[model samples]
Target: MSDKPLAPAIEGWHTMGDQPHLIGTRCTACGTYFFPKQSHYCKNPDCDSTDFEEVELSRTGTVWSYTNACYEPPAPFVAPQPFEPYAIAAVQLEAEQMVVLGQVVTGVDTEQLSVGMPVELVLETLHETDDDIKVTWKWKPVAA
Candidate 1:
């Protein structure tokens, strides 16, 4: 990796630090949270208000489901050479109760994870380019 400072793989989606949070937008009317943040019309049927504000979502959640990715992903994604298989999980946020999917941190696998197990948000290297070390949020067991 180049000497460039660490940067987010996808800007404006999550923050960087020892404690990171997914940046989501909440509807001002119904208090509904959106992951890929919605800035346009509110999706809540009962609430017509279009106003929204960006909020840092909960950094901890429980494993709702998980699976192993044994094949290389296709398209715009950058997969490391040798195609290392990894475990991915859908965790339900503590407060929002919405499931957000992400790759589990390296080393831990499906056998080591179970539903309802607590996990926390963490930053990990997604891929490296000559420009910078692209970092993204990942879910890892809270005890690990």
Candidate 2:
């Protein structure tokens, strides 16, 4: 049981530690980029190319939309004890022209966010155990 943090909640999404950016796949044929990586084939409906290259997505994006989870989710979804609401946002990466959804970093709430607000990617602990801490990517509103 090494002390290092556990693997990412979803493998191959983002690297851990300083200077992290979401890992995505870019279709060399159509110039399409996909987060979570598209290893099988190009996602562009008009293209049938299977060639892709892994690339780091932009670190900054604009808040395209947001919502708050006021209620605890059903089973299989774990919520922190002493349940508290969390904010989620759809951030539009400028270079990719795609919106990625993720939880907002702690201390940021719906009140502090608005459409078109600048945001950056961050790594956060989703949960921890005696052995390791589960990490995931989160969105944080950029400072003025």
Candidate 3:
């Protein structure tokens, strides 16, 4: 359990150890779905209404892209490192037509990663501070 604030943007990723889910908002008029859930406005560009409601995103998706972070990202991301490489990946939520990116788990084989490979969400620990811990969502290959 990370000491991080429970951000709604990552509700599914940092789970209570259950199936993970992302937050989303569906435009009632245009039938468009947005991740990070737009609660006030529609971004369809086709809809002119300001009505939106929050919904849970699909738990399952596919790997859209992947890479490794060889160097530390600039400040605000608090992970002290000797700069060991870490895997980062983008997952595509088919149901929402959206993508979410995060750091993949360590000690796993990533060479098999391919676009369109099935993945499931997981709660990933980012870093811990004295005052707060930060957590984010991640995706990995689904188990048989």
Model 3 worst lDDT window (10 residues): 6-15
Question: Which one wins by lDDT: 2 or 3?
Answer: 2
Once fitted onto the true fold, the runs of candidate 2 whose alpha carbons sit more than 4 angstroms away are 1-6
Per-residue error at 17 for model 2, in Å?
1.3
lDDT string for model 3 (17-87, tens) is 46766667788878788776676878777788787766778878888898887778887766656655678
Q: Taking the tens digit of each residue's C-alpha lDDT, what string does model 2 give over 89-125?
A: 9999999999999999988999999999999999887
lDDT of 3: 0.71
Q: C-alpha displacement of 130 in model 1, angstroms? A: 1.4
For residues 38-103, could you state the per-residue lDDT of candidate 1 as single tens digits? 978888888888899999999999999999899998967799999899999999997886999999
Sorting all predicted structures by lDDT, with the top scorer first, yields 1, 2, 3
The CA lDDT of each predicted structure is 0.92, 0.88, 0.71
Top candidate on lDDT is 1
TM-score of each: 0.95, 0.92, 0.81
